[model samples]
Target: MIVAGSPAAWLDRAGYHRIDSPSFDLSMDSGFILDGEVYPGGDLTIREARALRFVVP
Candidate 1:
Protein backbone atom coordinates (compact mmCIF):
# COMPACT_ATOMS: atom_id res chain seq x y z
CA MET A 1 0.00 0.00 0.00
CA ILE A 2 1.07 3.56 -0.62
CA VAL A 3 0.24 6.46 1.62
CA ALA A 4 1.18 9.28 -0.65
CA GLY A 5 0.67 12.80 0.63
CA SER A 6 1.99 13.82 -2.78
CA PRO A 7 0.58 11.32 -5.22
CA ALA A 8 2.23 12.79 -8.31
CA ALA A 9 5.68 12.71 -6.77
CA TRP A 10 5.26 9.18 -5.48
CA LEU A 11 4.04 7.94 -8.86
CA ASP A 12 6.98 9.54 -10.64
CA ARG A 13 9.50 8.09 -8.19
CA ALA A 14 7.95 4.64 -8.26
CA GLY A 15 7.86 4.52 -12.05
CA TYR A 16 4.25 3.47 -12.19
CA HIS A 17 2.85 3.62 -15.70
CA ARG A 18 -0.79 3.23 -14.76
CA ILE A 19 -3.16 3.85 -11.87
CA ASP A 20 -6.13 1.46 -11.85
CA SER A 21 -8.22 1.66 -8.75
CA PRO A 22 -11.80 1.12 -7.80
CA SER A 23 -14.07 4.09 -7.30
CA PHE A 24 -14.49 4.93 -3.66
CA ASP A 25 -15.35 7.78 -1.33
CA LEU A 26 -13.40 9.42 1.47
CA SER A 27 -15.06 11.08 4.43
CA MET A 28 -13.82 13.27 7.22
CA ASP A 29 -14.27 10.42 9.65
CA SER A 30 -11.78 8.42 7.63
CA GLY A 31 -9.09 11.03 8.00
CA PHE A 32 -6.36 10.30 10.52
CA ILE A 33 -3.38 11.99 12.11
CA LEU A 34 -0.22 10.06 12.86
CA ASP A 35 2.26 11.71 15.21
CA GLY A 36 2.11 15.35 14.08
CA GLU A 37 1.18 14.60 10.46
CA VAL A 38 -2.38 14.51 9.26
CA TYR A 39 -3.63 12.25 6.49
CA PRO A 40 -6.77 13.39 4.76
CA GLY A 41 -7.88 10.04 3.35
CA GLY A 42 -7.16 6.39 2.80
CA ASP A 43 -3.90 4.96 1.62
CA LEU A 44 -3.45 4.09 -2.05
CA THR A 45 -3.02 0.56 -3.36
CA ILE A 46 -0.21 0.38 -5.85
CA ARG A 47 -0.76 -2.76 -7.89
CA GLU A 48 2.67 -2.43 -9.39
CA ALA A 49 5.76 -0.37 -8.76
CA ARG A 50 9.44 -0.29 -9.77
CA ALA A 51 12.55 1.53 -8.69
CA LEU A 52 10.76 2.71 -5.60
CA ARG A 53 12.58 5.32 -3.61
CA PHE A 54 10.91 6.84 -0.59
CA VAL A 55 12.30 9.95 1.07
CA VAL A 56 10.80 11.68 4.08
CA PRO A 57 10.81 15.43 4.41
Candidate 2:
Protein backbone atom coordinates (compact mmCIF):
# COMPACT_ATOMS: atom_id res chain seq x y z
CA MET A 1 0.00 0.00 0.00
CA ILE A 2 1.21 3.47 -0.80
CA VAL A 3 1.14 5.87 2.09
CA ALA A 4 -0.61 9.19 1.36
CA GLY A 5 2.81 10.72 1.84
CA SER A 6 6.36 9.40 2.04
CA PRO A 7 7.61 7.99 5.31
CA ALA A 8 9.98 10.87 5.82
CA ALA A 9 7.20 13.32 5.00
CA TRP A 10 4.72 11.52 7.26
CA LEU A 11 7.24 11.45 10.07
CA ASP A 12 7.83 15.17 9.74
CA ARG A 13 4.10 15.81 10.04
CA ALA A 14 2.89 13.04 12.39
CA GLY A 15 6.11 12.32 14.27
CA TYR A 16 5.55 8.60 14.17
CA HIS A 17 7.15 5.67 12.36
CA ARG A 18 5.23 4.07 9.52
CA ILE A 19 4.55 0.35 9.54
CA ASP A 20 4.40 -1.49 6.24
CA SER A 21 3.36 -5.07 5.60
CA PRO A 22 2.25 -7.12 2.61
CA SER A 23 -0.37 -9.31 4.32
CA PHE A 24 -1.97 -9.83 7.69
CA ASP A 25 -5.20 -10.60 9.58
CA LEU A 26 -7.11 -8.81 12.30
CA SER A 27 -9.21 -10.65 14.90
CA MET A 28 -11.34 -8.80 17.35
CA ASP A 29 -12.35 -9.79 20.88
CA SER A 30 -15.83 -10.31 19.43
CA GLY A 31 -14.36 -12.97 17.08
CA PHE A 32 -14.60 -10.91 13.88
CA ILE A 33 -12.03 -11.96 11.30
CA LEU A 34 -10.49 -10.02 8.41
CA ASP A 35 -8.38 -12.06 6.06
CA GLY A 36 -6.12 -12.00 3.00
CA GLU A 37 -5.19 -8.35 3.02
CA VAL A 38 -2.63 -5.61 2.74
CA TYR A 39 -2.81 -2.51 4.93
CA PRO A 40 -4.57 -4.31 7.74
CA GLY A 41 -4.92 -1.11 9.69
CA GLY A 42 -6.81 0.53 6.87
CA ASP A 43 -8.84 -2.60 6.26
CA LEU A 44 -9.96 -2.82 9.86
CA THR A 45 -12.90 -0.52 9.22
CA ILE A 46 -14.38 -2.74 6.52
CA ARG A 47 -17.61 -4.39 7.62
CA GLU A 48 -18.21 -6.09 4.30
CA ALA A 49 -16.58 -6.57 0.93
CA ARG A 50 -18.07 -4.86 -2.11
CA ALA A 51 -16.93 -3.85 -5.56
CA LEU A 52 -16.01 -0.22 -6.16
CA ARG A 53 -16.83 1.23 -9.58
CA PHE A 54 -15.17 4.32 -10.98
CA VAL A 55 -16.95 6.14 -13.79
CA VAL A 56 -13.78 7.80 -15.04
CA PRO A 57 -12.11 4.47 -15.51
Candidate 3:
Protein backbone atom coordinates (compact mmCIF):
# COMPACT_ATOMS: atom_id res chain seq x y z
CA MET A 1 0.00 0.00 0.00
CA ILE A 2 2.40 2.63 -1.14
CA VAL A 3 1.18 6.18 -0.74
CA ALA A 4 1.50 8.59 -3.63
CA GLY A 5 4.07 11.12 -2.41
CA SER A 6 5.37 10.20 0.99
CA PRO A 7 9.08 9.42 1.13
CA ALA A 8 8.48 6.85 3.88
CA ALA A 9 5.77 4.38 4.71
CA TRP A 10 5.05 1.92 7.47
CA LEU A 11 2.54 -0.83 8.05
CA ASP A 12 0.54 -1.19 11.19
CA ARG A 13 2.43 -3.59 13.48
CA ALA A 14 -0.80 -5.27 14.53
CA GLY A 15 -1.54 -6.38 10.98
CA TYR A 16 0.95 -9.20 11.31
CA HIS A 17 -1.27 -11.11 13.69
CA ARG A 18 -4.28 -10.96 11.38
CA ILE A 19 -2.67 -12.02 8.14
CA ASP A 20 -2.20 -15.61 7.00
CA SER A 21 1.09 -16.69 5.49
CA PRO A 22 2.66 -19.98 4.58
CA SER A 23 6.12 -18.77 5.56
CA PHE A 24 7.38 -20.67 8.59
CA ASP A 25 9.38 -17.64 9.71
CA LEU A 26 7.88 -14.24 10.27
CA SER A 27 9.68 -10.92 10.76
CA MET A 28 8.49 -8.21 13.07
CA ASP A 29 9.56 -4.52 13.17
CA SER A 30 12.92 -5.92 12.00
CA GLY A 31 14.03 -8.73 9.73
CA PHE A 32 13.79 -12.36 10.82
CA ILE A 33 17.50 -13.02 11.50
CA LEU A 34 17.79 -10.71 14.51
CA ASP A 35 16.18 -13.60 16.37
CA GLY A 36 18.86 -15.98 14.97
CA GLU A 37 21.32 -15.80 12.12
CA VAL A 38 21.39 -18.30 9.27
CA TYR A 39 23.06 -15.51 7.42
CA PRO A 40 25.03 -14.03 10.26
CA GLY A 41 25.01 -10.28 10.91
CA GLY A 42 27.49 -8.19 8.84
CA ASP A 43 27.77 -10.97 6.24
CA LEU A 44 27.88 -9.59 2.70
CA THR A 45 27.38 -12.98 1.06
CA ILE A 46 23.67 -13.19 1.68
CA ARG A 47 21.92 -11.13 -0.95
CA GLU A 48 18.38 -12.05 -0.02
CA ALA A 49 18.08 -10.27 3.33
CA ARG A 50 19.67 -8.34 6.19
CA ALA A 51 19.07 -8.56 9.91
CA LEU A 52 18.72 -4.82 10.15
CA ARG A 53 18.99 -1.70 8.00
CA PHE A 54 22.44 -0.12 7.29
CA VAL A 55 24.12 -3.44 8.12
CA VAL A 56 27.03 -4.62 5.97
CA PRO A 57 24.76 -7.48 4.96
TM-score of each: 0.23, 0.31, 0.16
Worst 10-residue lDDT window, candidate 2: 37-46
Q: Per-residue lDDT of 1-57 in model 1, one digit per residue for the tens?
A: 355434576677788655556554435548777698987765643344456788999
Q: Give RMSD (Å) of candidate 3 vs. truth.
A: 13.6
Which candidate do you rate higher for lDDT, 2 or 3? 2
Error of 1 at 32 (Å): 0.5
Query: Rank order by lDDT, top first?
Result: 1, 2, 3
Instruction: Give the Å shift of residue 29 in candidate 3.
Output: 13
What shift in Å separates residue 8 of candidate 3 from its native position after superposition?
30
lDDT of 1: 0.60
Clashing pairs in 3: none
The digit string of per-residue lDDT tens for model 3 on 1-57 reads: 333433332444433223333344433443345445643333233234446657585
* Per-residue lDDT of 23 in model 3: 40
Tell me the whole-model lDDT of each prediction, alpha carbons only. 0.60, 0.51, 0.38
Which candidate do you rate higher for TM-score, 1 or 3? 1
